[model samples]
Target: MPRLPRADRAADAALLAGLTVADPQAAAAFVRRFQGAVYGLALSITRDPGLAEDVSQEAFVKAWRAASTYDVRRASVLTWLLTITRNTAIDAVRSRRPVPMGAELLDQLIEDSLRSPDLAESAVHRLETERAIAHLHHLSPDQARAVVLAVIGGCTAAEVSQREHIPLGTAKTRIRDGLRRLRAAYAGGDLEVDHG
Candidate 1:
C-alpha cells in the first residue's frame, strides 16, 4: 500500500489534534484512514483472519485511547498504528501454550528412520525444515516454541502439556492455533520457503 503523503499527514495530524478536543468526526476519519494498514499488518503477523480482525479492532481502539500521546515528531501515523499491531500480535502469541506429544513415539520414529538413506534428499529436507523454523520464529515466543515442539519434536498434546507445565487442553489449543497461524502465514506470502 502507498504511504500517506505529507499533505495527508498534516491533515491527519490536524484531525487528531481536533479529536483531542472532542471532534468525533475527526476521530472517525482517522480510523478510516489507517484501519486497513493496521489490519493488513496484523493479518501478516497472526495469519488468522478472525484473529487479525480482532487485533485490528483492538489496535484501533488502542490508538483511539492513546491518541493524545501521538507525537508526529517521532513517526508517521501509519508507523504508530503498525507498531500497535505488531505488539498486539506478539502479545496474542505469547499468552497461549502448545499441546504435547509422546516422547516414546518420537523416539520410535527416530529409531525407525535410522536405516533410511541420509543423502541428498535428507539435505533438502533439512533445508526445508530450517525454512519452516525461520517462519515459526515470526510467531510469539510461546507459539513459536509450541509449534517447534509439535512440528519438529513430534510431541503429543499430553507430552507437550507435561513439558510446558500447562494444561493438556491449553497445550492442544496452542499447537492447533500455532499450526493454523503457520498455514495462514505460508499461504499469505508473508513467509518465504526455499524449496531447494
Candidate 2:
C-alpha cells in the first residue's frame, strides 16, 4: 500500500514504527521532519549550540532505541521527541562543570542574537531576555556569578558552593539576595539600561 502524507500524527506514528523496525527510509524521514524542532529545544535548554547539537543527536538515538514505547494516545510524536530532547539537554547541562557567566558572555550572546536573520520576531523576545540578563550587571560580581550558576547553570547550592569554593550558606545567600534585588528592580522598572 502507498504511504500516507508526512504531516499528520498518523504519519508520524508510522515513521516512528518504521524506525523501531530499523527501516532506513523511515529513520531519515523522521530526522528530516523533526530535526529543527529537536535542535531548537536542545539549544534552548542547553544554551550552547555545540552542546545542543550533541544533545540533539543523543535524543534521536534515545528515541530510536525507545521507539517501541511510543504511544500515540499519550502524546504526539513531536511532543515525545521533544521531551527526550529536553531531558537529554538538561542532562548534558547538569553533567558539565558550570563556569561563571559574566556580562561579557551575555553581551556576546545578545550581539549574536541581533545578527541572526532568524530573529525576525524573536528579536523582540531576545531583547527582553537581554534586558533581564543585563540586570545582572547591577549586582556585585560575586552575587551575580552565584545567581547565574544557580539559576541559569542549574547548579544546586552545594554545587555552586563547590564550584565557587565558598560555603554552601554563602552561595545560597548570594542567590537569594541577588534574586531579591532583581525582583525589586524588575517590579520597580528601574533597570532600563542594557549596560552592554
Candidate 3:
C-alpha cells in the first residue's frame, strides 16, 4: 500500500501527537522540522550563537516535556514552538543582564511586542518591510549583508563579524554606514554624502 502524503498541518499534528506519547521517532521528526526556524529565532533574539544554541535546545526540550499540554486550538504546532523559543531566548537574555527594577514588566512588554499585529497595522508593517528590502540594493554587497544580518536576521555585530570572517569593528562600520545610507536615501538626501 502506498503511504499518503500528509499536509503540513497534518504532519505537524501527527508529530506533536507522537511527542505526547514519548515516541522517539516523532520527537526526531518534530525537531528536524523546526530546528532551523527555532535556531533562527533564538539567534535573532540572543544575537550570540552559543546562547542561541542553548536556548534552542532548551526550547525543544521544554516543548517535548510539555507536549501533552500543547493546544492545537490555540496555535499551530510551529507557532507554539516558535513562541516557546522566543520566550526562552528572551529569558536567557534577561538573565544575563544586570537585574534592575521592573524586570518582570520589561519581560511582559517584550512578550506583548511579539504578539501579532492586527490587519491595519500589518498592512503598514508589510509596506515598511517591502521598502526596507528595496533599499538594501543601494548598499555595497558586504554592507548590505551585514545590515540584513544585523537587522533582519537579528544578529549582533559580533555575529555578523564572525559569520562574515571580518573584524568586529569592520562589521560595525558596515552596519552603521549601511544604515545611514539607507536612512539618507529614505529621507531624500544625497546618497553619496559622507560625514567622514
Candidate 4:
C-alpha cells in the first residue's frame, strides 16, 4: 500500500471559493481531484455501485450549493467534502428503506417516548427525544410544523409547502430557521427544558 500525497490546502480552499461563485473550471478541477475518494466512500456506505454514483454526484452538488458556508477553521476542504459525501450517502440509503410506522403511529411513538420512562434499554434515546421535543416547542408554530413535516415525516420542502399551504421558499425558510434555533439553543445550553 502507498500513502497518498498530502492535500494542498490553499489550492483546495481557493477551488471551493471559486465553486461558490459557479466557476466552471474550478468545479471541474475540484471534482476531478476528489471524485475517486467521494465515490469510494459512497460505495462503501451504500454497497451499491449505481447508488454510490448517484450519491457521489448528489454530494458534489450539495458541496457546490454549500460552498459559501464552508469554514476553513473547522476543516480542510477534503474533510468537509467527505463529510458531505458521507451524509448524502446515508440519506440516499435511508430513503430506500421503508418506514414501518404511519404518521399516527409515529406520533404515538413520540408521545410514548416522552411520557414513558420504563423502557430501560432506551433511556438515553428517550431523554434525547424529550429534549428535542422541548426545543421544538420553543419554535414558532409555523416553524415547528414545517420542521416536523420535513424532518420527522421525511417529507421534502415541496411537500411541506403543499401541506402547509405556503410557498416553497417559505417552507424551506421555516425549516432552516427552526433547525438553526434548535442548534443554537442546544449548543449554548439555552434551552429552558428540564432534562431530569
**RMSD for each of the candidates:** 14.1, 9.4, 14.6, 9.9
Best by lDDT: 4
**Best of the two (1, 2) by lDDT:** 2
Off by over 4 Å in 3: 1-10, 99-196
**lDDT tens string, model 1, 1-196?**
9996443555767766756777777777777776766776576556688988988888877877788999886555665666677788656644443533245544443332323433443343444334555566666666665665655454567767777789998889888977777777655557433221
After superposition, candidate 4 runs with Cα above 4 Å error: 1-10, 99-196
TM-scores, all models, native as reference: 0.45, 0.49, 0.49, 0.47
Most TM-score-accurate candidate: 2
Runs in model 2 with CA error above 4 Å? 1-10, 98-196
All candidates in order of lDDT, best leading: 4, 2, 3, 1
State how far residue 169 of model 1 sits from its true place (Å). 35
lDDT of 4 by residue, 1-196 (tens): 6764333233889989989889777888788778877897688567799999999999999999999999887656776787788778768867886642245644543444234334452433345446667787777767877776665455678867876689999999998987778778766547543221
- Residue 104 of model 4, lDDT score: 65
Candidate 4 local Cα displacement, residue 95, angstroms: 0.8
Q: Each prediction's Cα lDDT score?
A: 0.63, 0.71, 0.71, 0.72
Model 4, global lDDT: 0.72
